[model samples]
Target: MSSLQFNAVLLEISNQLSAEQLEQIKFLCRDMIRKRELETIDTGRKLFNILTERGRLGADNKECLCELLREIQRHDLSDKLNRFESQSGSTDNQPDDEEKAKLDIATEVISENLGKSWRKLGRKLGLTDVKLESIYKRHPTELEEMAVELLKEWRKIRGAEARTEELIKALRACQYNLTADKVEHRLATR
Candidate 1:
């Protein structure tokens, strides 16, 4: 049957369903819609198959089925369908190795810049220099920006002799919670 006709049938079925049944149908439809949008037809179809196998889409829930079909059709999951088809060897839009390599290099550059920033912050706070995972746990937001700022400051102090008292005073001026002794220790270790 045409998708439009099928959708109409589904909507008619939905109108006759009780509130709980309607909710169940809505949940199923929402999930299917999202999967379809993401070009995951196999996943969506598997879910649909499960519902049918469980007798959730029996004669009584025909309206629910129609409603779901209508919603899916209305949302135009055709783009997702095309994406799935292409991925399954139906299209020539795939990225080549060189493009993929470039993306990988860019990703690494961003990661390294972020790492340098985190180590600088760790030094300033007298904290242990930790990996990305640990840094994520401590400051999840604006991490990249903070890291960049820390790296900039580190460059400014890179060639200078250890000015522990001056550095501690500067940190205090900025209202950072590090103490003079801790800053001294951190600078000494560096």
Candidate 2:
């Protein structure tokens, strides 16, 4: 969603909250979006996806969502949403992180298309099949936590985007270096 639409959703949800609760939510929201840059919340990811066409925030709490909108400078939408609520109107649409969570497996990671191969990432992360099996055999919870941490780190690293950009640069460079050795001979003969 656009920042305005997102802010409207947040305001709608906040209308059900108390002043104290709102303060807490705001603080948590910031923590979710900015504080825990490496540590991600499912809500934050979902919020980001929605905005970025994947459908996704920070602080670690609800209020941080509002803080995020403000950080992006969408106060106008926040104002309009709250105003609309006061006028006995309701936004019908709201963020459904909880519902989305229920629908999902809760273990989805971000892009890996250009990142390491799954087997390679598993080895690099020290969570290889053998390693994971060993951990699960001795400590299920430990394995779970390790997997979660690795996924969080993956979310923070834009490996796929970086790789794509690198590929594009390389392609452009190749376009300028079109003098193949065989082609050069043909041109010289011409």
Residues 100-154 of candidate 2 have per-residue lDDT tens digits of: 3321222232121212222334344333354334323343445445544444333
Q: Which has the greatest lDDT?
A: 1
Spell out the clash pairs found in candidate 1.
Answer: 10-66, 10-67, 11-66, 11-67, 13-63, 14-63, 117-147
RMSD for each model, in Å, please? Answer: 18.8, 18.5
Candidate 2 wrongly placed segments (more than 4 Å): 1-30, 33-45, 48-63, 89-190
User: TM-score of the candidate numbered 2?
Assistant: 0.19
Model 1 per-residue lDDT at 116: 32
Q: Worst lDDT window (10 residues) for model 1?
A: 74-83
Task: Please give, for residues 93-128, the per-residue lDDT of candidate 1 as tens digits.
Answer: 434555334323432333344343455444653433
Q: Roughly what TM-score does model 1 have, to 2 decimal places? A: 0.24
In angstroms, the error of model 1 at 182 is: 33
Q: How far is candidate 2 from the true structure (C-alpha RMSD, Å)?
A: 18.5
Kindly report which residue stretches of model 1 are placed more than 4 angstroms away from their true locations once superposed: 1-47, 50-81, 108-190
